[model samples]
Target: MRIQFMLNGSSETVDAEADTRLINVLRERYHLIGTHASCYSGECGSCIVLINGEIFHSCMTPLFRVRGMRVTTIEGFAKQHAYKEVLAGFREAGLSPCRFCAAGRILTTHALLEISPNPGEEEIAEYYRAVKCRCTDFRTYLKAVQYTGRLRRNRHRVS
Candidate 1:
């Protein structure tokens, strides 16, 4: 199958099996290793990517499903200014997620912030529940999300 989609802000065209996992095409074909491959079954959020600005597990998403859609991987997202805010928020909250789950955590934070720039505690918890992090505690994750929201709001105000 020939899948064409907007990757990170660029148009991409690749011939792959319709059943091929989006994660494999990203890591192998595009060398975008930031979208980690684990628990190929969508149970692990490690392979999370933004499909048209919404979170989706690349491992479970077939290449064909992304055709004509927009996909944003961590590598592409890291290039944007929002990624810097997320990193700063993590730093401010002293929340260092294990490398195994960093991509999922960061991407999830971006998605959440986009939906609610200043989300409440319960909202933060609900959104973050999708990403499983064994290294950091829930409180730290909450702090990070809150801090990121603050940073985003501040940026918006300044602009």
Candidate 2:
């Protein structure tokens, strides 16, 4: 099948089998290694991606399901060049031990923040729970939420 969609920010075409998984096409066919697939079972959240503004684990998602949907991977965020603050927060806190999980978490958190400007601790915890990082620790994740919150709060300060 010839798949056509917007990738990162550009329109592109991909030739893939009808039943091929999105992550496989992305990582193998397209060579977009930024979209890492860890569990390949859609439970790890390592292969999570934003497809047309909603989140989905690309590992189990089929290419046909995303034929016309816009795809956003870690590479897109890196290219758009807007992941500085949150990324730095995770970095300063040394959250890079499991780099595969970092990008998905940050992307998910960023997307959630877009909808809820000031997400409470409970909300953050709930969202973080859906993503199973290696550590299973919420302390650092909460700290990351706080860190991103500070940046968001400061950005819209009314003075």
Candidate 3:
């Protein structure tokens, strides 16, 4: 079947099977490798992608589900202003996630901040739970979120 959707900021159409996972189409068909396929069961969160402003585990999500919807992988999210600011904040806060979990965490953070720009520590913790990062402590990631919030506020204040 042919599915059409908005990818990043452009429209995309591809032929895929009924049971094909979104991650497969993304990585294999479109070559959008930023959305990794870790646990096919969706427990790893490594395959997380934003679909219509919400995070979905692409590994478990069917391609037909995203048909006509907007899907944003880490590659697409990287071009966003929020991504840029959050990344800078991560660096400034000395928060470094391993490559395996970084993209998923970033996407989760972006979704959280987009929904709640001034989220409290509890909220940050709650959202961070979506991404499993066994190698790093959550403190640095939380600090980065706080810093990004501040940066966003400052930018809005000047504009």
Candidate that would win on TM-score: 1
lDDT of 2 by residue, 1-159 (tens): 898988888898888787889998888867888678888888878888889876789998988888888999887877653477677656665565367676678777777777776788898887786578776478787777677767777867944
Model 2's number of clashes is 0
Clashing pairs in 3: none
Clash count, one per candidate: 0, 0, 0
Q: Which stretches of candidate 1 lie over 4 Å from their true place?
A: none
Query: For each candidate, what is the lDDT?
Result: 0.92, 0.77, 0.88
Tens digit of lDDT per residue, candidate 1, span 17-87? 89999999999999999899989988779999999989999999999999999999999999999999999
C-alpha RMSD of candidate 3: 1.1
Question: How high is each candidate's TM-score?
Answer: 0.97, 0.86, 0.95
- The ten-residue window of minimal lDDT in model 3 covers 127-136
The ten-residue window of minimal lDDT in model 2 covers 88-97
Shift of residue 83 alpha carbon in model 3, Å: 1.5
Residue range 37-145, candidate 3, lDDT tens digits: 9889988888899999898999999999988999999999998888998888888889888888888888888888889989998999987888886865788888999
